[model samples]
Target chain A: MNVTVKTFAQLREITQEGCFTLTLPESAVTMGDVITLLKSRSDKWSQALGASAGSENGSVLMARNQQLCDIQTHVQPGDELAFFPPVTGG
Target chain B: MFALIGDADFDQQWLYNRLRQEASQKAKGNVGAIVTFTGLVRDNNADGNILGIELEHYPGMTEQALTNLVQEAITRFSLTSAGAVHRVGRLYNDEQIVWVGTAAPHRAAAFEGANFLMDMLKQSVPLWKKEFTRDNSRWVEVKASDDKAALAWLREK
Candidate 1:
């Protein structure tokens, strides 16, 4: 399956990319699995996605198909998954 | 019915009057109250004297989140109408950041529904704020107090 990943705010700054295309095996089928795969690519990827500082929840927000979802949310082909820190706007 | 999210400036009075006008058609004499809350960009924060703030949002998700919040408020508070608007892009000190409101048959429901929308905006809306001081700019992180505020609403019966 393929997924388009998007990062926002500080996550974008860290990744230095706004969007990316990734091809993953069926076994790697969740938001967390995607993050783990990225972490395997570089040290920066590890910390950026590992657990952000000041995040009491210890992870960035995950959105699957534009709705907030848990990392365990299923990922399918052509899904849009986003990652970013906790929202602070009013 | 639903909310708006964009980078354009808004007229708060126009918004309220519009909501009232729309509700008057159906609510007639029943809508006796309207309540609104506006968030403004301030000059200071823990980050010191701020020059301005920049807001970012995930376009589709933000509108969906706000619309759902308004729907939840209407259902829970028996509101006759509800609306929310959030501004994105660079906003200077004292500029409007957001507006969320509700109209109801009574002041109590209007007040509660307005508060619910504001709280939900802080907790669930996919909008991000970045504070810009003269020297540095940083992404605003969600405060522990904000989570507590949202939790209070959830705990209410």
Candidate 2:
């Protein structure tokens, strides 16, 4: 299964791209798994993903298909997943 | 009322011209004053460092919030037409951050309408600001002053 993850703000800088697609196995998955996978890819993800000390609980907001979602939400193939820091705009 | 998700810069001249055109199109009634408010990004914060600012918003929620605010303003004050545009992404110091333009038959109405748009936008809009300093970055939190301003409007209504 492939998921296209959209990154914004701090996450975008860490990923160095607006969005990227990743293949996940057809097994049970959670936000924690995604973070672990992302961290394994590079130190940037490890730091920005909150695997590093002093990071804000990863504070990365999650949205599945444009609607805000919790970390436990079930994700399927082709799902549009997004990660972003706390939004600050007016 | 209009909202957009893009990096387009605001042209004051063009906006003023459009507002005049729309006002005429609406009616030639004794409309007196047009009130406009523009928000810009500043370089300094409490930390006293100079840098840029970044704005982020919830896509769907942002449009919905602005629409509701415009409707509320119209109900509060008999406005002809009110519009606002907010910029997203990284912004340099002194860049136009947001704008609110209101047209009404009287100064009071136009003034109230423009104020309503800005006050409500700061309080209710699901947008956030991040201040970038030379040494560090911080999320701009909603201030008590904003709450007081928004509350004052509600009290008057």
Residue B14 CA displacement from its true place in model 2, Å: 1.3
Worst lDDT run of 10 residues, candidate 2 chain B, spans: B148-157
lDDT of 1 by residue, A9-78 (tens): 8888887867888788778977778777877867766777875432335547777888766666678899
Q: Write down the lDDT of every candidate, Cα atoms only.
A: 0.80, 0.69
For candidate 2, write residues B1-157 as lDDT tens digits: 4554556788877776677667767767755778888888877877686688877775665676577677678678988777778888778898998888887888999998998787677765556677887677777755545544433432342
Looking at model 1, residue B40 earns an lDDT score of 86
lDDT of model 1 at position B10: 90
Q: Residue B97 of model 2: what lDDT?
A: 86
**TM-score list, all predictions:** 0.91, 0.62
Residue runs of model 1 more than 4 Å from their true location after superposition = A51-56, B144-157
lDDT of 2 by residue, A1-90 (tens): 889877766667667967788888656386556666777778777777674311223355566665545566677788887766654455
